[model samples]
Target: MSAPARRILLVKTALDGHWRGLSVVARALRDAGFHVIMGGMITGPEIVRAAIDEDVDLVGLNVGGHAAVVERIIAELRAARPELPIFAGGVLPPSTCRRLAELGVETYPPGSSLEQIVEAAQRLTGVEAGKA
Candidate 1:
């Protein structure tokens, strides 16, 4: 059998239970043949632990809270896994998106097409789509 696709850890950094954004993104990633681990409504610590424990190659954070909250999570993730690539999506405003981009965290706001997200996952994971 072929090896499993690269793993991606999908998480929500807020108390928000609205999974629409996460769901869509997760589906896109899966369709692109990624093994996505869903960490629902978790804290920053939880996110870090899951990423390490799962040995994920990429992290996709669904940011629903204030930028500061997501920033903390991003910081902790970076500190824990310096090489891990992180991408975020959700109700993030343009300013927040710019800040995230500055921190090297790619941000995908609402209405972002699934194709774009899948392409990014492939690039971030360094896994060719067809190989997955």
Candidate 2:
């Protein structure tokens, strides 16, 4: 049998209520054999708790311009699980992307292909594509 799929937790850092892109990305990850857990909209503490509770290998933050919220979530997640890899998607400003890059998180701004996101997930989780 194939190995258990790597778990990825996805959350919205703000109440943007934009689910279209997140849904597509989730589907792509699932199709690529990664087990995806949708956390909806949550706070930094809630995200930290969920990440630990779910035992996810990677975390995806959806922050549509809420740079501060995203930063806080990243900080909390890093504190609790310092080695857990993280990537982000949504309407991120160039500045926000740079900040996230500095923190070692990958950022996919608007127009990033689903393929790119999936590849990043695999890279972060250390799972090969279609073998996650």
Candidate 3:
């Protein structure tokens, strides 16, 4: 029998009110067979609560700015789900990306291809590249 689809929670930690990037990424992950939970432009506490409630396999942060915000969200998620995998994308500067990497969350800044993002999801979630 096939395995159940991995659940991924995608959240925007930035308050910028942008949804295009996260929406597109959600579509890609869903097409790649992930069960995506979209948490739009929420705060740190909300992100943590949703992550816990969803029982997500991975947390994808859509950061528009303020690495500290994303950082705090990462910490909260880790505290709640220590072994859960997390990834981030959207307009991350090199230093912010480096900082997130230091925290063990993969960052996909601009110029990142959809294929690469899909591959990261597969790698982080331990799902085969071509499978759900």
Candidate topping lDDT: 2
* Stretch of 10 with least lDDT, candidate 1: 123-132
Measured against the true structure, the TM-scores of the candidates, in listed sequence, are: 0.95, 0.96, 0.96
Task: Give the local distance difference test score of model 3.
Answer: 0.89
Which pairs of residues collide in candidate 1? none
- Candidate 3, residue 93: the lDDT equals 96
Per-model clash counts, in order, read: 0, 0, 0
**What tens-digit string does per-residue lDDT give for candidate 3 at 1-132?**
999999999988877887888888899999999999988878888888898898899989988888888888888888888999999999899999999999999999988989999999999999888886
Sort the predicted structures by lDDT, highest score first. Answer: 2, 1, 3
Residue 70 lDDT in model 2? 86
lDDT of 1 by residue, 7-37 (tens): 9999988898999778888887887789989
Question: lDDT per residue, candidate 2, 1-132, as tens digits?
Answer: 877889999999888898999999999999999889999988899999999999999999988756887888899998999999999999899999999999899999999999899989988888776678
- What are the lDDT figures for the candidates, one per model? 0.90, 0.91, 0.89
